[model samples]
Target: MPFLISPVLTPGALARTPQPTLPTGDGLLLRPWRAEDAPAVHAAFQDRLIHQWHVRSCDSVEEAAGWIAQWQQAWKDESQVQWAVVDEETDELLGRVALRQILLGDGVAEVAYWTVARSRGRGVAFRATTTLTHWAFEEIGFHRLELFHATANEASCRVAAKAGFTLEGTKRSALLHPDGWHDMHFHARVHGD
Candidate 1:
C-alpha cells in the first residue's frame, strides 16, 4: 500500500502530536522548517549537483519562498514533515531532509534530501537521515520510510547504507533525468527493525 500525506489534519491536531528534535553529531540539528528559512533554502538549491540528485531546480527566489510557505502550512496540517538541517551554534542552514509522499494509513513516507556541495561527504546526509528516521518512527509513528537514489549517484547510495536503510531493489526507468531516463535504487527502513 502507498501512503499519501493526510492533508486534512488541522493545526490543533498537529500541535497535539509530539514532534521530537534530533541532534546530529557535528553540531547539527534537525527541526521543522520555518518561513524564515526561505533564503537559505533558496541558496542551497542553486547548486547544480543538488539539482541533479534531488530533482529540484528553482527558477527564482520567489519560487523557493512559495515552496517554503507550502511547507510551513504542511507542518500545521500534520501532513508532510520538512526539516532544516542547521548548525547548532550559528543556526545557519546546511541542508534539508523531508518526508514527503506520506500516506498515514499505509504507514509509509518518502525521504528526500540534499546537502550543500561544501557540506557534502561530511556525513551530513547520513546523520540527517538517521536522525530523521528516528524522529519519523518515534514522533510520526510511521511504519516505513522509503528512499530513492539515482543509480548514478554513488554518494547517495553510500549515505543510505550508512544510515542503515535496506537496499530493497531498483525501479527501472523510474525517473527522467537531464541525461535520460535513469534507474532508481529503492531503500527502506521499517519500524522496529
Candidate 2:
C-alpha cells in the first residue's frame, strides 16, 4: 500500500508538493486527517447535498469529530484509508476521496468520494478519484476497483465515467435509502491498458 504525506504540513506551506510516491496526481494532494481539520471536515459533510447521497446525517460537529477519529484509527489499522483532499496552490480542503472494502483474498478494493458543494463544478472529485485509483492500481497492485452509487446520483455516475470506470450494470433493490430499497449502479475499472 502507498501512503500520502502532504507538504502542506511543512513550514511555510507554499511549495510544490513532493510527489506522494502513490499516484495521487500532480496538482492535488490527499493526506491523512488531522485533529485540527475536524471542524472543516464536519462543515463540509454538513452540506445536505453530500449527506443525501453519500452518507446518513451527522447532526453535530461532535459527531463529525468522532467520525474523523475513527477514520484515523482505520488508516492506522490498514483496514481503510480516507484522504482529505487539498489544493496544492492554496492548501484548502476541497473534499475527500477514499478506498475501502479491501478484499485481500480477491485482490480488489472499492472507491468512494465527495467534493465540497462550493467546489462541485470544478473537477475536484474527478481528480481525486483519478489520483486515488491510479495509486490503488499501481501501488497496491489491486486488479479491480469497484464503485457504487445510488441511481439518482447522476453527478457520481458522471465522475466515475470520466475517470474511465465502466458501468457494469445496476443492482436492483440493493441499497436501502430513507425512502426504500433502491437500485444502485455498479462500476469498475480494471488494471492495465
On a 0 to 100 scale, what is the lDDT of residue 190 in model 1? 90
lDDT of 1 at 108: 81
Q: lDDT scores for all predictions?
A: 0.80, 0.77
Top-TM-score candidate index: 1
What TM value does model 2 have? 0.83
| Alpha-carbon runs more than 4 Å astray in model 1 | 1-15, 18-20
Cα lDDT tens digits for candidate 1, 1-193: 7546653222443446544467876689987776777778788888889777666588777888899888777765667778888888888888888888877667788998888877887788888998888877876577899999998999999998888889999999999877778999999999898
Q: After superposition, how far is residue 186 of candidate 2 from its true place, in Å?
A: 0.1
Ten-residue stretch with the least lDDT total in model 1: 6-15
> With candidate 2 superimposed using the best TM-score fit, by how many Å does residue 45's alpha carbon deviate from the native?
2.1
